[model samples]
Target: MSSEKQNLKAGESHGQCQEKAEEWMQSTKDTANAAMDKTADATQSAKNAAPENKEQAAGFLQQTGEQVKGMAQGAVDTVKSTLGVGDKK
Candidate 1:
């Protein structure tokens, strides 16, 4: 091939390589940004749910405590009646 033709071809190849590199870099940056955005959203959602979860746990514990107290009282009554120590009326 002629020298001029070879030089032209080399320049064209360099241009194509540069374009492909630019496209790859852009794609990588976009993917990283998307991943960061998803992580931020997840963190925000967890922060928002913490208080609600704590309140629910507290409510459940209170309900369970009340049920346990009732059962204990009922057992005491049963024991008293069995022993004939209950109300003498």
Candidate 2:
């Protein structure tokens, strides 16, 4: 009788362990799914924002180019003046 009781207890313990393992696996799956969902959402958001970002960046670059061109022209003018070549109308 004692042997039978030991066997039953061991079986029950094994079943409990299996149940816990299954629960843990399920939790891991849920976490993975949530992470995937969040990643997808972030990817979509980035895609949606890309065109606007590109346009803004292009505008900024154009403005920067204009400023640089102006500065270069000013430098050239300064150099010409320093060389006493400023009388050329």
Q: After superposition on all CA atoms, what RMSD does each candidate show versus the true structure?
A: 3.1, 1.1
Cα-based TM-score, every candidate? 0.64, 0.94
Global lDDT for candidate 2?
Answer: 0.98
Q: Which portions of model 1 miss their true places by more than 4 Å?
A: 65-89
Clashing pairs in 2: none
Tens-digit per-residue lDDT, 17-80, candidate 2: 9999999999999999999999999999999999999999999999999999999999999999
| Superposition error at 32 for model 1 (Å) | 0.8
| lDDT (C-alpha, whole model) for all candidates | 0.98, 0.98
Q: In candidate 2, residue 48 scores what lDDT?
A: 100
Error of 2 at 68 (Å): 0.6
Per-residue accuracy of model 1 over 8-57 as CA lDDT, tens digit each = 99999999999999999999999999999999999999999999999999
Question: What is candidate 1's local distance difference test score?
Answer: 0.98
